[model samples]
Target: MITIEGVDAGYGRLQILFSVSMKARSGEITAILGPNGSGKSTLLKTIFGQTSVYNGSIKLDGVELSGRPPHEIARLGIAYLPQINNLFTDLTVRENLLMSGYMLSEEERRKRTEEVFQLFPFLRNMLHRKAASLSGGERQMLSIGMALMRRPKVIMLDEPTANLSPKMVNTVLDVVRRLRDDHGFTVLLAEQSVVKALRLSDHAVLLVGGRVLFEGDPSELLNNKELGRMYLGLGGG
Candidate 1:
């Protein structure tokens, strides 16, 4: 499990999160839903060690990760996929996956690469294709596959469905679900597609101006008409 307690973080001299706290349970999808400038991305960056934590603690299964660097955090079984530039566009799909697991032995790299290919079978055929040649959805898939090469326990994705067709949105969400159901990964997704994300997630965190206004089962957010309307722009259920 990933836990954040009283976390205050942001870019240097520009704090975005305000003592925020939340928990992403093991083998479950936790959706962080909020409006623009609400510090959703900043929170993920803080967890990944891209942002500075002015106060509080972040832990994964009892190990303190508050002051660690991003690479160290990744080594601690946390994988972060930002909204863009997550893939090496000029590299072949196979090369990108290989680079993601460069620290592993050749045998382990090959084994993990095959596992990722199993998760995204379409990439098996496009092994030699440069990442830039793929469609938006396929690029996203490849980005995720690269992240999966390390087989981290927690995968944090910032806007996985951004700027995609509806079909692709569903495809990405389905993969997120599979990461939990089939692979036992703890998935943390920050998404703008609130309704869709809420439908697919087990828990939801509603953020506004860097504060967590609500955190509980998605059904609780969906059923609260006022909270839904105020934060999510959803009509009364």
Candidate 2:
């Protein structure tokens, strides 16, 4: 399990997260839900070591990861996919996957690439196509495929579905679910589509102004009429 305890982090001198604490249990999807500017992305960045932590601890299993650099953290089986700039737009689909697995041996890289291709079969046909030429959904898939190349134990995604079509959104969500069900990856994602995210996630954390308002089963947030409508903008089902 990935544990965050009393984590205070931000960029430069600007603090965004305040004593934040949460747990992303193994083999489950932990959805980070919040409004705009609520520090949702910053929390993910902190976990990935993109932002500095002023206090507290971040651990994977029993290993402390707070002061470690991003690459070091990634080597510890944690992979982070930022909301944008996650893909090498100028590179071919296959090249992007190869770049992500540079640390592996040549045979291992080839083997992992084939494994990710199995997860995203459409990418198999687009191996030679430049990433910039793909549609929004296709680009998202390629970005995820790159992360999967690492064979990470925990996958963190910042808005895997931001501006895709409804069909593409479902496709992305399905892939997220399969990553856990089929591959046994621990998934943590900051999502904008609250209703869809809640439905897909095993647990949810509601953040407002950098503080956690709720953390438990997604249904608790969805079932709370006042909190849902006021904070989450969720309507009655």
In candidate 2, what are the lDDT values of residues 18-113, reduced to their tens digit?
989999999999999999999999999999999989999999998999999999999999999999999999999988998999989999998999
**Model 2 stretches with alpha carbons more than 4 Å out:** none
Please list the C-alpha lDDT of all candidates, in the order they appear: 0.92, 0.93
| Number of the top lDDT candidate | 2
Q: Report lDDT (Cα) of residue 58, candidate 2.
A: 95
Clashing pairs in model 1? none
User: Which lDDT tens digits does candidate 1 get at residues 1-237?
Assistant: 998999988889888899899999999999999888899888888999998899999999989998999999999999999988999999999899989999999999999999998899999999999999999999998999999998899999999999999999999999998998999999999998899999989899999999999999998998889888888889865
Judge candidate 2 at residue 180 and give its lDDT.
93
Models, CA RMSD each = 1.0, 0.9
In terms of lDDT, the poorest run of 10 residues in model 1 is: 228-237
